[model samples]
Every structure is written in C-alpha cells, then in structure tokens.
Target: MKRILTAIVLIAIVVSLVLLGKLWMITLLAGAIAVLAALEYRTISAAMKSPVPMWWTIGAIALFFLAVFLRPQDTITAVVFSTLVLFAWNALATGVDRVLGETASGVLLLVYIAYPLTLLPQIWSLENGTALLLFLFLCVWCGDIAALYVGKNFGKRKLAPTLSPNKTWEGAIASVVAAVGFGMALIALGNWLSTNGSGYTRLHTSAPWWEYVLLAILLNIAAQFGDLLESALKRGAGVKDSGTLLPGHGGVLDRIDALLLAAPVLWFVWVVKEYFSLGSF
Candidate 1:
C-alpha cells in the first residue's frame, strides 16, 4: 500500500510538471531530484570510505544544471573540465590516501547523476517533447513494476546473485517485455487522442511504430543495466538501499537509478535521429 501510494504521488508530480511544459519547471524538477539523489549518494560513498564533501558536490552539480540550461552546447566540455579542475584542487588540500577515492567518487557522482539528469530539460525542448518525456516515464515505470512482481513470483535463475540476490533473469526479461508493451499502449493512446481531436499531447509521438518499438527495447535494456550498476555500487559499499527518504522506495537515488541511465539513452537516440534527419521524434 505504501509503495502504491508513493507511486501515485510520484506520477502526479511528474505529470503536473511535464504538463506545465515549461523548461525551467522541468529543470527545477531535475535539479531538485539531482540534489536529493546526490545527498543519498554521499551517504553511500561515506560507507565505502570515500566521502564526497556535500557542499562542494552540490555546488558542482548546480553549475552543471546552470550550464545545461544556458549553454547546452558547451555543457559537456564544461562539466568534464570543471570536474577535473575542482577535484584536482581538492586533492591539494587532502592526504594522498583519501584524495584518490574522494576525487574518483566525486567525478563518478557528476557523470552518473548530475550529467544525465540535465538531459531532461533538453528532452523537453524536442519535438513532441512532452509525449517523449512521458513515454520515457511510462516505459521505465512499467518495466520496474513488471520486474518486481514477476521476479518475486517466478524469478529463479539468478541474474547477478553476487551483486543483487533478488534480481533474476526472468524478471529482467519481464521488464523488457512490459516496457515494450506499454510503449505500444502509449502510442495507441496518442493516436486515439489525435483522432478524437483531443488537446492531450503527452502521449503522442510522431515517430513511426517500428522506431518507437526499437527505441523502447533500447531504453529498457539501458534501464536494466542501470539497475545492475547501482546494485553493484551498493554491493561494493556493503549497504542495502541508499537511504530511507521514501517509504517503501528506499531513497531518491534508488528510485531514479533507472532514470540515471535511461534518460541519457533516450537523449542520445533523439540526438542521433535528429542529426540524421531521419524523422521528428
């Protein structure tokens, strides 16, 4: 019941913000999520004996979002160079033993968390951006739901017993199937809305059916790997769950772990499609 309620509230918040269709609002949502997830990540890092300074980490991430909002073309280069300089400077004030781990972990936080999230607003700027973003949310959410229920009931062959004992190959396949099925559902919903002359734009995507299916498969695969990646991190850190911020959902990081990678994959696909002038997504 707690999980269901959280999912409801979360979906409401996301739908509200995405429907507002403002770049700043989307950026604001992404920024807030990034900060919360970063804090949780700091906890995990500390447990692993590589603490990232909270204020410094947050400051860097703030700059990242700012660059993404203002000079998106330059955000990648800026993020890379700024992280290097920032961490290198920090090393000067720390002992060699702790400096390496701290610096490495700090860099990982930016790449793994901050950078990918910045793509949310950029995605919102794309053609049929609202639909695209919601499609992403739907696929990921459904995939997660399918994986949990299916894995719980029928999961037997271990996917990665060493990293995440609960995960199984059966659940992983179910996640992909669920994501693809939901992707088609959203596409059908969009078509129905269009045919009825409804004002709803959140479910529509101009991409062909085949393209969307291929894209859904890719996104689901990325999400699954993302789940594994976070699991590996937690396993290495000798902890379970990133934090207790969300009841029945662990922490912000745990919830957005799939988004961390899925967002980037979606964005990359958009970029490639646009660059090739294949079709408007």
Candidate 2:
C-alpha cells in the first residue's frame, strides 16, 4: 500500500512537470511510451504463441511514427491501409511460421496499440488540446484511484472474476463517482478562471457543463473496459503485469491501460461534436 502511494506521488510529480514544461516534451514522452507499449504487446503476442511477424511489428512502429509526427490529412486512410497490409503480410507468412492465429493477433496489436495511440497527437493539436488532454488524464487517473479504494473497502460482487478477480461492482460505482467529481471540478475551475480572466482556462466558455459530465462518464466506462481488455490479454498470454518496467507499479502498460482506451474515445467524441456543431451541450 505504501509503495503504491509513493509510486502514485512520483508519477504525479513527473507528469505535472512534463505537462507544465513543453508540448514537445509531452509528445516525445507519449511517443516513447507508445513504443514501449507496442514492444510489450509484441512480447505478449509472441508468448501466447500468437505469431506476429517481425516485419509486421516493424511496419506498425513505422506507421506509429508517421501518425505521430506527420499531420497528414490522409492519416486515417494511411493507418487503415497500413494495418490491412500488415495483416495481409502476416497471413502470407503463416505458411513459413505454420501459425494459425498470427493474423488475428497482428490485427489486434495494430488496432489496440497503434490506432488508439494515434489519437494522442490529434488531441494535442486541437484548439483546446491541452485542456482536453489534461481532462483525459484526470478522468482515467481518478477512475483508477476510485476503483482501487472502493474495491478494497466495499467490493463484494466481482465484476469479472475470470479476467480480473479483483474488480468489483462497488469499485465501478466508485469510479463513476470519482469521474463525476473530477469533471465537475474541472468545470468549476474553468468557470472560475474564465471569470477571473486567468490564462489557465483551456475549455471554451461555450462548452456546457453537461458535456464535461458526459465526457467523464464515457471516459470512466472506457477506462474500465481498457483495464479489462488488458486483463483478458494477460490471462490469455498466461503472464502477469505486462512487464516489470516500473517499480511498485506493474508496468507502463498496466499504469496507462485506462488512458490507452480513454484517450482515443475522448478525441473521437470531441471531433464528432466539433464536426457536427453540437454546441458543446
């Protein structure tokens, strides 16, 4: 428990510093994290006897880089084509490797790790990008913290006993509560800043409180799914904690599992709202 708390504090400090320092720093850090996560995914797939080709992994990483640095308008098409080609190539290589499940595994890896992560750069480049990113981080982090605390204290019904026995309905309730609190706090803070003429406000005044609430709820749900998704992967791979990449915390993948799922969902919602002129309500 002490170790977990200490790790959380250290992570918070590091994240705060990075967020305050430079935008490029955040991008670089996210890119490096994505690479590490991709490697972890590859390792898990290989261990599960899911044969992902070396060439496919390389190509996926290349696509990741292209998605991150290049603001190409055709990025979505490029990503789809790249993923398809990688899967097709893996299918072709099945004869050499004699693996039955390589195609499915390769496809999973590309979509789960690469495609969702591509949204990070897009979120960073939005008009209110920084606030949106911060909101994402908060939603995921708060959800996780709430789940942990509530699960420890009041967890009676297991949410998914097979994949993750530790998760519980009580934890899920706590997660939603925490998400709501965090969202409302952000709204209040934004309102305060806007009224005071402070520069820290990033959310638009036109954006409604209900939007934050909806976003928070969606983010919480996504975070839960993300954690479960990883749990399912780990169970299938017959391993624990992705890797021992972090001290006290399981691994980078474990720590950022919620963020991995929530980030893209948030970005997608924001994009859809913007495109359709939803008026932030």
Candidate 3:
C-alpha cells in the first residue's frame, strides 16, 4: 500500500514537472535529487562505519548539478577538481587508517550517483528535450515494472545471485521487451501529437523503429547494470535500502539507481547524433 501510494505521488510529481516543460524546473528537480541521493549515500556510508565529510561530499554533488544548469561544458573539470577536494578533505578529516576507503566512497558517489543525474537537466535543454526526458522515464519505469513482475513469477535462473539475489535472466529479458514496447508506444504517440498541433511540440522523435528498439535494449542493459552495481555496493556495506526516507521506496538513491546510468547513456546518443546519423531521422 505504501509503495503504491508512493508510486502514485511520484508519478503525479513527475507528470507535473514534465508538463511544465521548463528548463529551470528540470534543473531544480535534478539538483534536489542530487542532494537527497547524496544524503542517502552518506547514511549508508555512516551505517557501514565509513563516514566521510558529508557536507563536502553533498556540496560537491549539488555544485555539479548546478554546473549542469549554468555551464554544461565545465562539468567535467568541476567534477575532477571536486573529487580532488573530496579526497583531500577526507584524508585530513579522518585518520590515515581508512582514508583510502572513505575517500574512494565519496568519489564513487559523485560519479555513480550525482553526475549521471545531472544529465536529465542537460537533456531538458535539447530540442524535443521534454519528449526525450519523458521517453527516458517511461522506458525505465516500464522496464523496472516488467522485470519485477516477470522475475517474481517466472524466474528460474539467477542473473547475479551474489549482488542481487532477486534478479534473474527472465526478468532481464522481460525488461528489454517492455522497454522496447514502451519506446515504440511513445514514438507512435509523439508522431500523432506532433502532426496534430504545434502546442505539443516538445515531445517528438524521428528515429525509425529499428533504431528505437536498439536504444531500448541498450538503455535496459545500462539500467540493469546500474541496479546491479548499487546492489553490490549495498551488499558490501552490509546494509539494505540506502535509507528509510521514503515510505516504501527505500531512498532517493534506490529510486534513481537505474537512471544514474541510463540518462547519461541516452544523452550521449543524442548529443553525438552526427556520428550515429541520429539527427537525419
């Protein structure tokens, strides 16, 4: 019940943001998510007795998202230097015994949890960015849901028993099929809406069915990898569910682990369109 209610509220919030279709709103949403996810990471680290400078880590993450909004090109440089600062901060703050481990944790969170999230804002600034962002969320959510249902009912072979015991090959297959189906549905809807009126102009896709299918498969694979990576981290830390902030969602990190990888991969495909001949479509 809690999970269902949480899902409903999240869907409403996401729909509202996407409907607003403002770049600033997307940036604000991404920035908030970065901070909340950082908090969840800090909580997990603290539970594992590997606490770092929470303020520095979270601040650097927030700054990275801000950089995405104000200056996209400088994000890499900013993350590099911020990582260095995080290393130095943790080394000096904590004893030498766990400096390397703790420092690595902070840096990893920046890359794994924080950086990829900022891509949503970047995607929002593109042509048809609103549609693209919505497509991303739809495909990911469909894949997640399909994977869970199919895996629970028909799973026989474990995909990664050590990292995530619940996942299975059947579920992975289901996720890919569902993602592709959802992508095609979005494309069809986008085309119809694109032709009908200019008012609904933000959501459009020119890619052919084959290319979109390939994209669906690619994103599902990336999302699954992100999920496994987070699961491994949690297992290593000897904890489950990064935090209890959400009623049934575990934490912001739990909700976004898949997006962390998929968003950047999807964004990369768009910005590098000439090479892939994506813009022609």
Candidate 4:
C-alpha cells in the first residue's frame, strides 16, 4: 500500500512536469519513453517466441522514432508502405524458420508499439494541441485510478478473468464514471480559465467549453480500450506484467499502455478537426 501511494505521488509529479514543461522537453521525454516501451514490447514478443527478425525489430524502432522527430508532413503512406515491405522482406529472409502465423504477429507489433507511440509527440504539434494532450492524459489517469480503487474494495464479478484477473465489472463501471466526471470537471475548468482567467493559465481565451468535453470523452473511450488491449496482449503472452521496471506498476509499457493507444486516437481527432475546420464539439 505504501509502495502504491509513493508510486502515485511520483507519477503525479512527473506528469505535472511533462504537461506544464516546454514542448522540446515533452518531446524528448516522450521519445525516451517510446524507446523504452518499444524495448519492453520487443521483450514480450521475444518471449512469445515470435519469429520476427532481429533486424526488422531494430528497424521498426528506428522508423518509429524517425517518424516522431521528423513529424513527416506527407510520409505516412510512405511509412506504411515501407513498414509493410520490410515486414514481408523480414519474413522472407527467415526462410523456412518463419511460421505461417508469425507474419501477422510482426504486423501487430508494429501497429501496437510503433504507430501509437509515434502519436504522443504529434499531439503537441496541433493547434490548441496542449489542451488536447493534457486532456488525454487526464482521462487515462482518472480511469486507471478509478479502476484500481473500485476494484480493490468493491469489486465483485470479474470483467475478464482470462485477461486481467483483477479487473471487475464494478471497476469497469467505476472507470467510466470517473472518466465522465473528470471530463466534465476539465470542461468546466477550461471554460472558467478561458472566461474569468486564472493564474498560470495557458488556455486560449476564445476556446469553447464543448471542445474540452468532446476531447475528454473521446480520450476516455480510447484509454479504456488501450487498457483492455494491453490486458489482452499480456494474456496472450502468458505473462503477469509487461516488465518489472517499475516497482509496483510493472513496466513503462504497463504504466503507459492506455496513453499509448489514446495518444494516437486523440492525435487523429485533433488533426482531422483542425484540417476540416470542424468544431471539436
């Protein structure tokens, strides 16, 4: 219990620094995080006895970070094509060693680890993007806290016993409740900060309240899926935790799993909304 509390406080401090710090700092931190997560994922895949080529695994990590720093304006299609081609080549290079199902596993790793982590920094690159990024983190953090607290005490029925044995239906419901409540609070806060003004405020003066709500809800759903997806991955891998880097939280991958998934979805929504001049509400 003490370990959990200490972990929470440390995480809160780190998150506060990241969200409030300069963009470069955030990008650097996120990049480092991406590398660590990629390593953790590679460990899991190796443990699963995946036939992914060593060179391709290394290349995928490189390409992922390249995409992050370059923030390529028109290279998404190129990246996808390149990744697919490399995947095929890697499979072919393995010759008879590559099993029929191993190719799909390689593709899944790229999609799971590479694609999602690439979006973390992209969130900061959009207009009014800081708010969206912060909101994404908040939704995931709130949902995770809610699930933990609710499950530890009030949990009854299992949510997915095969995947996450600790997860419960009560916890899942609590997570949604916490997400919605956090979203509403953030919306209210954003509105208040925009209107009446406040100390240390970075919000745009003309930003609408509805944008906060919409972004929050979208992030919440994505975050939930992210957690569940990670759970499923761990189950498939026949592991308890992604790694033991963190004392109580498992690994960087375990801690940031939801953020990994949510970041990309949030980034896409922001990009589409900005390009189309569509209101977030």
Candidate with top TM-score is 1
lDDT of 2 by residue, 92-181 (tens): 755646434776777676678766666776676676665666677778888888999999998999999999999999999899889889
- Candidate 4 lDDT, tens digit per residue, 120-226? 66666555555556667778888889988999899999987877778888988787778778866765666577677465344332346666666666777777778
Off by over 4 Å in 4: 1-17, 51-59, 77-95, 99-103, 197-201, 204-211
Q: What are the clashing pairs of model 1? A: none
Q: List the candidates' TM-scores in order.
A: 0.95, 0.86, 0.93, 0.82
Please tell me which model should have the higher TM-score, number 1 or number 2: 1
Task: For candidate 2, list the clashing residue pairs, or say none.
Answer: none
For candidate 1, what is the TM-score?
0.95
> Which ranges of candidate 1 are over 4 A from the true structure?
none
Candidates sorted by TM-score, descending order?
1, 3, 2, 4
Residue 236 lDDT in model 1? Answer: 85
Candidate 3 residue runs with Cα over 4 Å from true position: 47-49, 197-199, 275-281
How many clashing residue pairs appear in each of the predictions shown?
0, 0, 0, 0
lDDT of 1 at 40: 91
Per-residue CA lDDT of model 1 for 53-160, tens digit only, reads 887788888889988898878888777876776677667877778877888888899999998899888888887888888889877889999999999999999988
What is each predicted model's overall lDDT from 0 to 1?
0.87, 0.75, 0.82, 0.70
Ranking by lDDT: 1, 3, 2, 4
Tens-digit lDDT string for candidate 3 (151-263): 99999999999999999999999999999998789888888888986656656776676887888888888999989888877898887898777898898888888988898
